[model samples]
Target: MPPLHILHIDASARPGRSGVDTRGSHTRRLTHRFADRWQAARPQDTLTYRDVGRQPPSPVSGEWIAAAFTRPERRDEAARAHLAESDVLVDELLRADLIVIGAPMYNFGLPAQLKAWVDNVVRVGVTFGFDRSRPGEPYWPMLPPDKRLVILSSRGDYGYDPGGRLESVNLVERGLTVPMGYLGLTQTHSIAIEYDEFADERLRASISAAEAAVDDLVGKLARDFAEAAKPSLAVA
Candidate 1:
């Protein structure tokens, strides 16, 4: 459609891009390349980048929970203050047409910081709706159905893809997918570099492959979204 608004999030604790730093984060490299490629293709599009690894949002606490459950209009000053950060995060998510997340697997799961980010965005009466009377469907996704999600991830070991040896234990992508899907961002795609700990030819190959995949993904998504946004012609 019009210029796309992309939200780029980096959740790696490491400071530098891969290949540049000996111990850099692979996810960062992919995300940067993705953003660069996207901008080169569609110069008019806008990007909002958030580095949650270094500056994570506040974790969900008792006060945050209390404030979230409280009705917005009924909330007092304290309640509003508790949810202020969450409010900003939710607003950013709502504005994005495409969300790109750089998440590296930490101990078979998401990093603590990224999880905290997730907790903040999945707000009540904001990204989702809840009702006590509706027994069959008490919860509903609040975001529009067309929002797209891209998770560029890295892992210490290999075989984490679907049907792979370590798929069951690989919770990085699944963890994000469940929460994001709950918010109606089901158009998801993921590409990850594996064998990170090995730091050998395998890791190098994986990174190269992942970069190519990211480029392909960016091109495909940019074209697909543009096509989908075009108006259809009426038949005579």
Candidate 2:
């Protein structure tokens, strides 16, 4: 079986402690456990890490927008170079079989750096397309059919669940999941840990609960991988 590639991304700017830019905190813990399980399950598998918090690219510009939409063969030198960084990031995402994103909710939504990464990767004609002719079917995905996405989110407040008080205003889950679904990644799961109203003990408990959820998710992924590795018998 070919080795599965995991693209692990952490969007937190904080290295430690509970603060606004605490991007890497939850993800660091989750990814550490994920990597351990993945390596144990598939010894030959590779893990690629991308830290968007510490080094974030500038927001997309008009030139990048135009260049990204242009046909590769017809693009001028300047236009080709305009989207080089973004293109590279998108390519990394495309090559991965599984993606694990660690994002913290900031100002009721995702961080600016993570948003920029999303903009660069979720390009039309690349990750997705629009099919106007098919009535009521507005969009189509260009990504591979088998990729999976797992999101680990840390929230200051716990109000994003269905029928929750702040569900109407919460944009973090809705924003991320919609785009991921649009890209044909249907097997999506999330681990959300709320830290606002909890004391140190309670916060630790929440983290523990979230970690257990992650363990369960990892087990499922490993089982799926094992099943995929089995050879199918040819029918006469």
Candidate 3:
């Protein structure tokens, strides 16, 4: 296999324009850390970045719906025009071996910009197939289940982890996993910096924990890709 292709998506509204702003955005920091770590380990590995927060892909419209459902050869020029951006988004997703999303929890859920990206990529008859004739499991993923999804997130509140006090209300992971699952991304991992609103000792501690997790996850992924990219020993 060639060097691993990584797609990095940043969904936080913060642009990291200023020194202070960049320092404050935990998601941005974690994403940078992961990208740098990967590149250091394997310079050949590719990284394609999309900042949805700043330049969000257009939301799906009625025309998009019609265009998506229509058969490719049958689609008119108007339909083709409607799905142009969506096609690009889906293609980017299909080309990646690893995907890293930097998400900041907004109101206990995913940011609208990130949601738009999800809506664009998880298309019918493209990323997923719907078979009405099937007795059960009508919707099946069409993409290969080989992608690794890493989510670097930050939350203003705590207890979002499984069995945590506020786990029931935490929708960030579910929001991402459900839609991405439709596109066959089952190898998922999340590292969240919680207690943002707290902005105190607890917040610092959360950031520390998340930073450690990022180091561990990126180290493992880099190692795997490096090993995979190595040439096998030639037989005599």
- Which is the better candidate, 2 or 3, if ranked by lDDT? 3
lDDT of 2 by residue, 34-83 (tens): 77777887788888888888877668999998887788788999998888
lDDT per residue for candidate 3 within 112-216, as digits (tens), equals 999999999989999999979988889988887668899988888898999999999888889999888876888899999888888799988888888889989
Cα lDDT over the full model 2 = 0.80
| Candidate 1 per-residue lDDT over residues 13-79, each given as its tens digit | 9988988887788999999999999999999999999999889998999999998998888999999
lDDT of 2 at 94: 88
Mark the 10 consecutive residues where model 1 has the least summed lDDT.
15-24
Best by TM-score: 1
Name the lDDT value of residue 75 in candidate 3.
98
Identify the runs in model 2 with alpha carbons over 4 angstroms from their true place: 17-24, 131-138, 234-236
> What's the true lDDT of residue 197 in model 1?
86
Q: What C-alpha lDDT does candidate 1 achieve relative to the native structure? A: 0.93
